[model samples]
Target: METVRTRPGAGRQGGSGRRLTRRQAVGALVAEAGGSPLRRTMGVGQLTLLSVGATLGTGIFVVLGQAVPQAGPAIVVSFVLAGVTALFSALSYAELAGMIPGSGSSYSYAYATMGELIAWVCGWCLILEYGVSVAAVAVGWGQYVNELLRLTVGVTLPDALSAPPGAGGTLNVPAALIVVLAMAVLLRGAKESAVANTVMVTVKIAALVMFCAVAFTAFRAGNFQPLFPLGTAGMSAGAASLFFSYIGFDAASTAGEEARNPQRDLPRAIILSLVLVTALYVLVAVAALGAMPWRQFAGTEATLSEVLVRSVGGGNLWPVLLSVGAVVATTSVVLTVQYGQIRILFAMSRDGLVPPLFSKVHPTTGVPRANTVIVSAFIAVLAALVPLGSLADATSIGTLFAFMLVNLAVVLLRHRNPDAPRSFRVPFSPVTPVLGMGFCVYMLFSLGADTWIAFAAWMAAGLAVYGLYGIRHSKLDHGAGPQEGA
Candidate 1:
């Protein structure tokens, strides 16, 4: 029952008009209860598992090979660096999530503190972040699926079917299929997806732990020599690449509308999931480095599996076991990240920034069925066509841009609403958020020139969409304020 305000001439392009007050943003949740509301069934445990599941795959299993060659054995340090950078943004996300508690994550935060236009930009960046990252992870999953098939049946899919176009395959069939499978799971409901993710997260965690035990048996102190062979620049580049690994730590924030007690659980889940994932990432990196030479990782895929086999000898069963874990791991990542992406679109649709079909929740399942199907279909096609390295870099740049805005949003909100109730407040206020912005900029710079060009193109396309459609159709422009309930 909060009053809503609309700006009469707010439809003007480029202006920061029609901003949602913090109270208005939170109040929309209550209003939606009478409409097609998302079920509030997730607890803190499920939220943590959702973040962990979304995070624990791709990077360690697949990108570790790509990153190790850049930083040598010092790739261990690169993981730590990326984690610290993610820590700063995670703090910002925690504060805003507790205060706003919306499905849009950073998009909602921008709408509250900035304006609808900025929020549209942020939402567009999230589309790149989640959508492309899911495709990247699915591409990696195809590799593990190949390995698993090799060990079990002494067969693998043909290269044309198993890999993306530039990577020797005409289309990555397994990658596309995995996304389709995750789409089916999501169509069930959020609670069911959480249950499935919990099981997968457990399997992946256990698999990594098993890898550590076997790898440590062959740990060599000499492997640590020449740690800085690629120099500090190499280490920074590696950190930028590995930053993609930490992208899903704030995933719990995307579940604000579905969490049973979002104000209390969202902050705890965001911080806890990041801390846990960082610790595990560092440990796994150390184990792999000690067991193998950094130079050998250059062209390797299925790195952890290879490390386990090489460490324990060819006849051992560890590689097969690790492959199983990897399959489960990547599957969960695709599921949870797609879930987050759909929720972000749902929020945007509710604000009249996207098509209304995205926000329509199915009564029986309490999920956005059409949105899930359409997004998953596009992601599947992207996974089928794009190379993993390109997708990963694109996702990293987009995620970094979105995170920079989230950090800025925190400072702006604090300045504008000094006495606003916050279950969690980032320590040191503007200093922490400013450092967060600085770190994001540094990582963004570390990315290659081609990545920048691609990002620029993506941003240009987003602006075009906003100008053509989003600006004209925005709820605020119609003197209805933000859409409320059905």
Candidate 2:
């Protein structure tokens, strides 16, 4: 067991009973990484596929329709902006992931460099980012599932079973069902889920490539006439919406314990996945917009399918194939993101932050089965009852907050441990992280008032949980196995 010894005069607990310093936290993380049993079956290609699969889901299929109405053709600019912000954060993540090589993602980074309270807050924010994101994607997935059923089987799920409580129905059965199924795959093992993700990503990519090919055939230069109809503010708002699409590249970093050579491969995969996903997103956006007026995208639940039907003229197989692609895409997103969430919680639990049940990695499968079940149950409830719009807003805000903290952590680590080995470094140290933080803050404010309200409530709840339970139960306070007083 790894233990972090508390300081007498240097650090304060921040209400967690016993505080953890940067050096002590790093020691604990390193010890834990050494003792982990996760299988390192992923290479750069598999890791890249994981990031791409996690990223290329609802953002491309569902968000485009919502963003286009805000910025017209300038939604393309929004994609670039979101990509740039993600690039900065990805570079930061690469640097930290290379150094830490642990499973907690940004939450781990924060713990190692910032302290326990900051780490706890970072983990809580991630719950909003990943957990809520799965719910949102499941809700979006429900749309494609409904469309696929109607297109292929000539059947539509009734509103009572198809829509969420806030979306004119008692529950979204398909959304809830998909979450449950994903939980089953995750419970199997990391390598198993990864293999499944690879096949799904390949088919999903083929479908997008087909959509782009057919869309380009009907492309019209006239569609580019009014590029910025809603102006800069509208473009910024569109960027905020599009930002959610770029939130999953760091999902690659969450698998550090299961990586062959995390220090080198994790950084490479993070940057490579970002480049590939961005290129695909830009191509798809250009193709779709060139093929149809941006105004037509607004209020479209299944925009890509609509684009396929309109471009190729309906009564064909292409639209149905595209609908299937959307299902595969969003399903992959839920899978990868849910995987990231569980690993982060498992890391926290191992450190005696949350309940010990979350840290119980099954001996046979080398997976956190209990954590997966808990997360699945919680997300399924949200997917079945909550509105997608609310869940999405919370996700964007949470992800942006986590990204900002990650950028800050990178700078702090560099100053605190200049001798630490870093296979990859963020090119322009303070400048890059500073700019990344600025972008995150800008996007946070761009989110609606309701999102802010929801975020505040969630944080309040997290703080309460920490004070009432996490503080007294922390391993650092309990004198876990061995002591490392940094």
Candidate 3:
């Protein structure tokens, strides 16, 4: 174990009373006194599947329809564009995850490289990104639940119970219910949750493969004629929207403390998961566009299932089976994404950035029981009341902001500590991270004004909370002795 000390009077403001300096040492952030409280049971394979499970469902099953209306048949181009953007950030994430393996993900990275204030802001953005993303994914899950009901029972829940208000229904019961179910699974233990996610990921991948097989059978070249029906601006907007599809790729980094081999496995899982997800997204988009006209996707809720239904005719088993697969797919997404949210809060809480309750891991399960329940409950309420599109856009903006910080953190960390050992490194260093930041800014600008306003409001609230609680209770502020074992 090694000890690193900050400069004298580090937390004190300078003469100008504006610049406040308090950065957590990277060594202290990664090191725990004995070992991490969270169980280290996940391997590279399960870690990759965790990311896959969190990402594969929502975008393809739900947001694809929303994006198609923006880009027409060129939505495939949008998927590729979004993937490229994610690749840049993914490289940065890989580098950081390997260098500083911790459960805080970007938040802890920012704390080590940037200062505590900026770190708090980054953590706040993650709260928005992961928490609301769980809600957004859960909302999508409700749509598939309704589809499954219609296919099997031949009767679906009424709009009031199946949809969010103004979208036709007063409350989304299925959406909230799915969150509760995921919460229960999480309470059981990390290994159990990972195993469940792996099974669901397998089923979802097989379902998409089945969809492509059947969808390609009905492929019509004519449907793609006016590929840029909505033009370049539309394509950009579509790409911004589709960026949400790639949100879960970096999720593996959040399991830093819980990974069997964080230095090696975290980087491998992040990059591998992103590649697999991007390929699946592009293939599914092509199959969907070739089989159905772009205009028809505008307002479709269960786009994939409907595509199968129309392609194979209404009276077939394919649509029914696809709906079942979707239900499983979305369920897996809710489970994994919710798990990410819980872990992030656990990290923040341990640092005294949030309430202590979140950091309390259950003795037997090695899970944060209270944190899981609270986060899941809040997400369920949001999923029940909020529309999917609004939740998705908000989540994208928050995630992009947090990712931009991660990219910047990579540059800062490399400049500050060039000799730090890393299992993975971004090939181009500063250039790659700079490009990642640029892409993030470009997508951030593409989002609507409303989303920006919401983001600003959320950031303001976070600052207030930090000022009132986090600033005083931070372990660094209190001089909680150095952590052991970097």
Number of the predicted model whose TM-score against the real structure is largest: 2
lDDT of 1 by residue, 1-486 (tens): 233554565344324432322223444543443243899999999999999988888568767888998999888899999899899999999999888887989888877666666788789889988998889888888988998899888999999999888888798999999999999999999999999999999999999998888899999988989889999888988988888788898789889889998889999999999999999999999999999888888887637878777666866388788889989999999999999999999988987778999999999999999999999999999899977565467777888888999999899878766777899999997999999999999888877888888888888999899888877777766655543210
Clashes of 3: 1
Best-fitting candidate, measured by lDDT?
Answer: 1
In candidate 2, stretches whose alpha carbon ends up further than 4 angstroms from where it belongs are 1-23, 226-234, 298-302, 387-392, 481-486
Evaluate model 2: give its lDDT. 0.83
RMSD of 3: 3.3
The global C-alpha lDDT for each of the candidates, from Candidate 1 onward, is 0.84, 0.83, 0.83
Candidate 1 Cα outliers beyond 4 Å, as residue runs: 1-4, 7-36, 69-73, 164-168, 225-237, 293-302, 314-316, 386-392, 482-486
lDDT tens string, model 2, 1-486? Answer: 234455443333443233544233565576677678777778888888888888888667767778889888988888888788789999998888888889999988887766677888999999888898889889889988998999899999999998987889998999999999999999889889999999999989998899899899999978977888889888878877777778799999889998888888999989999998888888898998998888788777537768777666867488788888989999999999999999989888877789999988899998988899999999999999988675467777788889999999988877767777788889989899989999888888877899888888889999898888776676666556333334
Candidate 1 whole-model C-alpha lDDT, 0 to 1: 0.84
* Pairs of residues at least 3 apart in sequence or in different chains that clash in candidate 3: 159-169
Clashes of each: 0, 0, 1
Residue range with the least summed lDDT across 10 consecutive positions in model 1: 14-23
Tens digit of lDDT per residue, candidate 3, span 170-201?
A: 99998899999999999999999999999999
- Cα deviation of 356, candidate 3, in Å: 2.1
For each candidate in turn, give its C-alpha RMSD to the true structure in angstroms. 3.6, 3.1, 3.3
